[model samples]
Target chain A: MPKAELLDPQGQAVQSAMGRLGFSGVVSVRQGKRFEIEVEGQITEERRIELEHLAETLLANPVIENHTLTIE
Target chain B: MPKAELLDPQGQAVQSAMGRLGFSGVVSVRQGKRFEIEVEGQITEERRIELEHLAETLLANPVIENHTLTIE
Candidate 1:
């Protein structure tokens, strides 16, 4: 997800359009990215930690985005 | 999320990078968008349906992407 402090232009655009379309129930919106990855084997504790590291370093930009990794 | 039959170049790139970084456990990857929307009231069944409509019409490109709306 994007940093809370940062402005999300795409989200803003969606919110504005919602208002125009009479969807007044929506108060705010923030957009983010999701990745669904398929792994070869079970997600062991060690592998989970490794994937988290990859999510932090490669998948998400720590400077602007905060990410959470879920293995299911 | 992108359609199952469609090619996800971004996911492919990430998968390739994972291989280069020696994270061989990962077999495949799919990329998608997540929108965290704040609504004014509780997500009643009617509101849920409305939001789903918005998600389908505005947030996601039905031609290429599939979407799921979750209200928490």
Candidate 2:
């Protein structure tokens, strides 16, 4: 699984989004280190790019969010 | 000098406390990482203890706060 850690500078909105996505209680945003998501590996580079797009567009804020992905 | 980074799980109070203490905008509680304080070297261990006490009691939330001190 690849682990994605999303850091949100603006907490409330991120929390709201998580809630909207039905990931409310599962996600924790403390400090700048907000949500940590573990996703399955994709078969192709295109899929990886798609995953990244999903994370950036839907899971995190592009303006104030920072992310680190670790393949484990 | 010693650098103390205080992380507050509850952002509003930390911001309030820092504001009350005149720390105000210097403190940033984004996500969970809050204020960063830099203190001068103490002459004795007693002084170090005193400093720690001040930090824990006043600067952070003992219930949910986390801090790291670095002497530099």
**CA lDDT of each prediction against the hidden true structure:** 0.91, 0.43
The 10 consecutive residues of candidate 2 chain A with the worst lDDT sum are A30-39
Query: Can you list the residue pairs that collide in candidate 2?
Result: A30-B31, A30-B32, A31-B30, A31-B31, A31-B32, A32-B31
**lDDT tens per residue, model 2, B2-54:** 12254434444434544565332322333333332323444367655654664
On the 0 to 100 scale, the lDDT of residue A14 in model 1 is: 90
Across residues B1-72, which tens digit of lDDT does each residue of candidate 1 receive?
999999999999999999999799777899999999999868889878888898899999999998887667
Regions more than 4 Å wrong, model 1: none
Give me candidate 2's TM-score against the actual structure. 0.28
Among these predictions, the greatest lDDT belongs to 1
**Cα misplacement distance, residue B23 of candidate 1 (Å):** 0.3
CAPRI verdict on model 1?
high
Worst 10 residues of 2 chain B by lDDT: B23-32
| Candidate 2 Cα misplacement greater than 4 A, ranges | A1-72, B1-30, B40-43
In model 1, which residue pairs have backbone atoms overlapping below 3 Å? none
lDDT (10s digit) by residue, model 1, range A1-72: 999999999999999998998889777899999999999878999999889999999899999999998878
Give fnat of each prediction, in order: 0.89, 0.08
TM-score of chain A of 1: 0.94
- Assess the local accuracy of residue B46 in candidate 2 as a C-alpha lDDT between 0 and 100: 67
